[model samples]
Target: MAESVKAPKTVKVASTAGSAAGSGAAKAASKKKVKGGVINVAVMTLAAGLIATMAIPAYAFNPQGADAAQFKASAIDGMKKAQSQSVEVPETVAASAVARDAASATTEEQLAAAKAAEAARQRAAVSLASYASSYSGPSVSDFLANPPYPNFSLDQVFSVAQQYIGTPYVFGGSTPAGFDCSGYIMFVYAQFGISLPHSVSGQAALGKRISIEDAVPGDVVIMPGHDGFYAGNGNIMDAPDTGRSISIRPIWTSNYYIVRLGI
Candidate 1:
């Protein structure tokens, strides 16, 4: 009743062969994965080396160095060499200071002179007004005895006259302290905004030339012998010669020239 079943030898061998094939496939797949990982790591290492080589040299050659300390030292060294030959300030600078001081003094002198001249003008106006109020003629007769110079105005002549009221007459002076014939003419008309020539002869060509009969109060009455401004009433004011002061003279001279200095 006991029949032992005999196993098939071929079946056992086939089962063993299938198990071996499965194990070989799994090992090949693992080896392929590891190879790919090794290849990726090598590529990364080569790229890192190339980048470091290029960047290091570029930084060293440029003036703006990669390191802050190196750049500062280089800049300081260059500046020290450039400033080695500068010169000191010279002594001539003192002379410039002195010249500036002189200019300031000159400006002060001009200011003082201008103030004195203004004061003198005010005094003359007051004196003339007082004298006119007490006079007896018809408002200080216009100069010419015969035919008055229609071109010359008495007001214009009076303007020139006011500049010399109490001013001391000097021999060759043209200023407030003194005056000559030409200097008197030059100074008086200058106050009236009329710029006359320095001499009497030169003044004779100022406005319109006329005769003594045609001269007005403001007219400049010239003489071949002497020169003066017509001050009405046959009287002429002049800074006559070197000895005489600025005073009234006669316009009835035999030879005289008359000029009017207005438009």
Candidate 2:
């Protein structure tokens, strides 16, 4: 019985030893497989990096060649030449500019004309202001001889008339103080021993009727209710109105007739 038990125990121990040896051999084989897989992964990664490097475009990896630089310079020069080309102005735009210049010139001319007109007005006002209550002009005979009138014999009448140029206007008074239209004429002519009326109608009826074309200085110019001594051309030396004075200005009426005192 003792021998039988001992033999069974020895057999069981041998079986366990054989199982432990087989497990150790399996573990060693698994470690070798894992090492081989790591080496394979490393090789695959290196190959992928090499492929990525080769995938980059060749131009990006290299400098520009001489042909590319020459082409770029040629394109830049062509652009510069095109930029330097002269641009044409539109016809409408050019015409508009010309019109503006003409308008400016017209404005300047108008300004000049207005200034000249103002100057003329000032001169006329100055001339009007120069007269006073007591003024004597040039010698009447000398002034009248310039045009050689046919009435040269009436030199005393003209001289007396001119001396009263600045006399004030009055209703009917006929003195050196003041005189009316007909009063002025009657007074001036009376100084030379000539008889005249103080009425324009009476004076007009007494003189010899003559055409204005044949009238001379010292002739009588008769209108509707007015009369004056003819100075020359269309001017008269007369006391024009009540508030105004005697003046040697242009005649006021176109419906006037000429007459001579026959002196």
Candidate 3:
């Protein structure tokens, strides 16, 4: 009975609700700590990645290494090979170049020939001038006194006149060296003892006016300010202007009539 009475003494025990509430509070605290730790780890990882990127050199991402150098060398070599390659010229293009060269050469040759011909003409003119300037032939007085073709016919007079065909023209000259228009007539007729004036009008008046058709080769051709020997067939033989030799040529004008000297 005494043991039973000692066990009946009251014992202090905790409530279920308080225990559950305390357990919930501790669980919330643990969750909060775990979330904070996860956030800290993520922050540290981002900081380490930023530091690593900053530590790297900018050239690390560039492709300018040995491969780029080899590509540049290959490009340069290709350019050199292209420059050294020989391109064949087309036959048509080559022939065109040759033809152009030949044409240029021919033009040069033609120019040279023309220059030579002009020089020759000038030389001939100079020779004639020199021969006229240095002449020492018979004078008009000597020729008149001697009268080489005395009693000569008109044909003989013309034949004698032809001997001085190549004589040069000179102003107011009547010798064999050079002769003017009227002076030539005077000198020629002097050989046949025919006294004539050394003037166009005077000589024209001393002869008979004749038609051109009826004129002979020895007849005188009288123009407005000129006169010559009628060479028949509308031609005349006379000393022309300055720088020209005595020659036979066609009558240049229709304003002229024939004159028979011994009419």
TM-score of each: 0.38, 0.42, 0.49
In model 1, what is the error at residue 29, expressed in angstroms?
99
lDDT, each prediction = 0.63, 0.73, 0.82
Which candidate ranks first by lDDT, i.e. highest?
Answer: 3
Better of 1 and 3 by TM-score: 3
The segments of candidate 1 whose C-alpha lies over 4 angstroms from its true place after superposition are 1-153, 159-166
Tens-digit per-residue lDDT, 116-154, candidate 3: 878766765665576567868776677778988777688
Tens digits of per-residue lDDT for model 1 on 1-263? 99999879888888888778878888898898899889888988888988877655433666465577444555446557666897776678888898888877757779899998777666545544544454353211122222223444568556657557555444445555555567666655554445666766777766688666776676777777457778877888776643346666666565766777755
| Candidate of highest TM-score | 3
Ten-residue stretch with the least lDDT total in model 1:
138-147
Total backbone collisions for each predicted model: 5, 0, 0
Worst 10 residues of 3 by lDDT: 5-14
Residue 103 lDDT in candidate 2: 76
Evaluated at residue 66, the lDDT of candidate 3 is: 44
lDDT of 2 by residue, 65-99 (tens): 54464445544475576689778999999999999
A best-first ranking of the candidates according to their TM-score comes to 3, 2, 1
